[model samples]
Target: MTTSTYHGIYAVVSRIPRGKVATYGQVALLANLPGRARLVGYALSALTDPSVPCHRVINAKGEISRRNGGSEADEVQRHRLEVEGVFFDSHGRIPLELFRWRLYADE
Candidate 1:
C-alpha cells in the first residue's frame, strides 16, 4: 500500500502556484510531515508528470537543488521557473521572500 506520506508530498507540491516556489522543508511541513524535507526531495525527483511542476520546488536556501542525476537537469529546472516569470538573483537563487508560495488553508 502507498503511504500517506507519498500522497501528502505530491499534494502539497502540487499546491505551489505558478510564479512562486516552495522549499522542500516547507512542503513536508505543509504536508504535516515535519522534519521530512529529504523525503520531499526524493518524491520530487521521482516524479515524471509535468503537470506537477516539480521545478517550482526549491531548497531551503532558495537555490534549485540538482535533480537526481545531472547538472543539465538543474539548468532545465531554472529555465522552467524562468519561463513561469520567477526571477533569480546573480547568486542563482530565487528570492524566497518575494516568490515563495504562501499556502493558506482559507485561500
Candidate 2:
C-alpha cells in the first residue's frame, strides 16, 4: 500500500479511545477505504509510531488476531486491552457488543 493509505489507516486508528476497540473493517470504513480490512491489519502491523494505539484494533470476532510474531504479540495486545478494562471470555473473544467503539459524529 502507498504511504497515503497507511497514513489514512493511522489517522482512523488514532481515534480509537482507550477502553474501547474497533474492528479492522470498522477502521477501514472510517478511513474511507471500505472492504479493506486486511489492508488495515497490514498497515497496523507495519506501524512504528507508538501513538497509534494499534492494539485497540481487533478482529470482527473480537479476538486479537495472531500476528507474524505469533502468540507473544497476541498476549501483548490482550494485556494492553485488559489494562484498559476490556475483558475476554473463556473463548478468548471480547464481548464486542459491550466493548466495540461506537463512533459518534463528534469524535
In model 2, where is the ten-residue run with the lowest total lDDT? 98-107
Model 2: per-residue Cα lDDT over 20-79, one tens digit each: 999999999999999989999888878899988999999999998996645597898899
lDDT per prediction? 0.84, 0.90
Segments in model 1 whose C-alpha atoms lie over 4 Å from true places: 105-107
> TM-score for each prediction?
0.88, 0.93
Top lDDT hit? 2
lDDT of the structure predicted as candidate 2: 0.90
> What's the CA error at residue 73 for candidate 2, in Å?
1.3
Q: Compute the lDDT of residue 35 as modeled in candidate 1.
A: 97
Candidate 1 TM-score to native: 0.88
In the range 19-96, model 1's lDDT, one tens digit per residue, is: 888998988899988998998887876777777878888899999887556669899889999999999999999998
Whole-model lDDT, candidate 1?
Answer: 0.84
